[model samples]
Target: MSEPSRIAALVVAAGRGARAGAGDPKQYRLVGGESVLGRVLALLGAHEAIDRILVVTHPDDGDFYARTTTALAPAAREKLLAPVQGAATRQGSVAAGLARLADGAAPEIVLVHDAARPFLTPDLVSRAIAAAQAHGAAIPGISVVDTIKRVDETGRVVETPPRATLRAVQTPQAFRFAPLAEAHRTAVAAGRDDFTDDGALMEWAGHPVVVFAGEAGNVKLTHPQDFAATGGPETRMITRLATGFDVHAFTVGDHVWLGGVRIPHTRGVLAHSDGDVVLHALTDALLGALAEGDIGTHFPPSDPQWKSASSDRFLAFAAERVRARGGIIDLLDATILAEAPKVGPHREAMREAIARAADIPVSRVSIKATTTEKLGFTGRGEGIAAQAAATIRLPEEDA
Candidate 1:
C-alpha cells in the first residue's frame, strides 16, 4: 500500500579490509587526501532521488566515522540510519544494516553496496534502482575481462569457466525490501552464512535478477595495489595545480555517459545535451578565470540533439572553442569522484585520453582523486563528483 515508500540505500563498510595489507583498515586509508569511507559516502549522499541512506560499519569504527563524516548534507543526515553491528560475513552486515532501518519505514526497494568499491558510479546506482523497480532485483556487473579458472585444493586450475557466461559482480545490489529482508532473515534463521553478496542469497531464494553492463573502471579496492592500479596517487602530480569540480544529477534517460567513455549507466546529465560534467568543468576551469561560461552555455545540456551525443566530442569541441577564442590550453587538471570505478591508476590513462582528445601534450594534464572525508553528499558517494581546472594563455592585445 502507498507505493511501498519508494527506494532506500544501504552501504556496508563494516569489513576491516584486512586483505589490503594496510596499517589500518583499507577503508581508513587516505586516497587523494580523504579516507575510503568518506569517498563512498560522498557518492551515496549526492543522489537526489534516493529516499534514505543507511551506512553499516563496524562498531569500533563508528566513532571515527561519526567524527570524520561530518560533511554530509543536513537533509541526508536526517535520513541517515546506520553503522549497526555487522555479522562476521558480508551477509551478516546486510542483516545488520536492515535491522537498523526504521521499524515501520522500510523502503519498497533497497540498494546494498560495498564500501571497498570507491569507483562506484551514481549512474550505476541509478540503473540498479531502475532495474529493481521493474523486476524484483537487479545488479550492476561486467563480463570477466581476464581468463577464468576454477582452482582445486592445491591451487591448480581444476576447470576453466567460460568467460562468456561468467560475470564479475559489483554493487550496489538492489532488491525489493520485503523480499530481501525475508531472504536475509531466512538465511540467518537457517544458519546459511556462506552467502558472499545479497544477489547470491536472492538467487538461492528463486529470484531471477537482471544484470546490467558495468563500467570497466568500476573496481573493488581489495588489495593495497588496487589503489595504485585504479588511479590512486603514485601517478599524481605535485605542482602547478588546477582543480575543477562539477556535478549534474539524473534527468529522464536510458543511460548516462562519463569520462568520455560510454557506460551502460542510467540517466543522462541534467544540463545541456551531452551533459558531460567532467568536460564542462574542465572547460570552465580552462577558461574559468577568464570568465567564460561553463559547458552548459557553450554546449547547452538543454539542446535536444546533443541529446545522445558523446561527451568526449564535447570536450573536443570545447578545446576547439578555446583555440578559436585565442586561448592556448595549458595544463589541464581534473578529478572524477564517485563511489564506482577505480580512477588512480587510470589517472595517467585519463591524462592520456584528455591530452590525445584535445591534441595537447599529455604532460599538461593532471588527474587526482579525493573523497568527501565522509562528511557530505560526496561522503555518501551518491552522485558522481568531478573537479577540474585548466591553465591557459591568451593572445596579447593588439595595440
Candidate 2:
C-alpha cells in the first residue's frame, strides 16, 4: 500500500489582541470552561487528518501558552510541536510557523488556522483537507449576508459591488505544502509581506484559490463581547433550575456525614453509598436540571460498585456531566434539616467541600442548616434530611 498523505495544522496566535480588552490575550481567554486557543488546539490535535500541529506565539506569551496547553489530552499533547516565536504581524506569525514545519519532513497538505477561532469542527477540517487534495489552494468561506460597497479615501461611495460575489472567509485555509512554502518565499524575497492570509498570498503568486462552504457558526473571537456569544441556536446559552430532596434515617455509628463532612453525632444515616443526604440531594438536583434522572437512576443501590463510596465522587460526576454537555454550574444551594449534629460549625467546610467537588468557585456554593421545629423525622432526631436546588446553564438544542 502507498503511504498515506500526512497533513499538518499551523495555528497563528501571535497578535496582542488589544481589541479583546485588557486580559491575558484573546486566545488564552476562557470561553465556557476551556481557553479559546486551547479549544482550537485540542480540536485540531485530536483530528485524524492532522498528523502534526504547530503554534506560533509572541515571545512574551510563553507562560500563558504553557498554562493553557496543560489541559490537552495525551494524544493531542503528543501531536503538538514546540511553539515558534512570531513577528509583529499575523502574516509573519504564519510564516514563522511554516518555517518551523519546513525544518522537519514537511506534510503534503497544511491547514493554516487562527487560534482565536475555537469553534471549527472536525467535519469542517475534513472538508478543508478534501478541498486541498482536489485543488492546490482552497479556503472555507460563508456567503456575505449584508450589502457590500466600495468607498474612496474621501468617504465617497465609489461603487456598489454585487453581494453574490462577496464572501466572509474563515480558517483553517488549506493548501499544498510545497506550493504554499514557495509562495511565502517569493513574497519574502519581494518584500511583500502585507498579505493577511495564506490564500491571499497564493493569489499574489498567481495560484488559483477555490472557496468551500464554511460553517455559519464558526465565528472568530475578536472582541470581549464575542466570547460571550454562544454562536447559534444549537449552542445558545439557557438557564435551568432544579430541586432535589433526600431523607436518611439514623443508624448506629460514631459520626454522620453531611455534605462530605464528618461530624460527631448520636447516630448515622441509613442508605446505600455514603448516605450523605446533602450530596445525594445535590446530585439529584443536578440530574434533575439536565432531566437525566435522579441519583438512583445513575447509581442504583442494586449495584455493588457504590458500596460505601464517598458522596463527593457522586457530586463530582454530576458536575462533569454538566461540563461534558457544554454547560456550567452557576450555583448549588443545599439546606440540611436536622435538630441534632448542628450543621452550623461545619457550614464553611461544607461549602468548600462542595465547591471542590463541583470544580466551581467557593462563593458559588451555599450550605444552610435548620430544624423542622421538632415535628418530622428530622425533628425527632431519627434521621437527617436535605433539600437542594441547583442552577446551571447549558446550550439549547432542538429536539
Model 1 ranges with Cα > 4 A deviation: 1-5, 73-76, 154-158, 233-399
Number of clashes recorded per candidate: 49, 0
Top lDDT prediction, candidate number: 2
Question: Which candidate number would show the highest TM-score if scored against the true structure?
Answer: 2
Instruction: Indicate the residue-level lDDT of 324 in model 2.
Output: 77
lDDT of 1 at 152: 87
**Model 2, span 296-361: residue lDDT tens:** 898999999999999999999998898778887889999999898988899999997887787666
Model 1 C-alpha lDDT per residue in residues 1-399, reported as the tens digit of each score: 444446788888888988887576777666553467766776676676687777887878866687546544334455566567777888888888887774666788888888778777778888888889899888888888799889989999999988999888888888989888888889888879899988889998888988887777778888879877754434332222244568866656655455554444544456555656666677667545445566567666567777757667767776666555444566777777665445654566566667656656566777777776676665664466688877765433300
In order of appearance, the predictions have TM-scores of 0.59, 0.63
**What is residue 375's positional error in candidate 2, in angstroms?**
38
Instruction: For candidate 1, give the lDDT of residue 323.
Output: 53
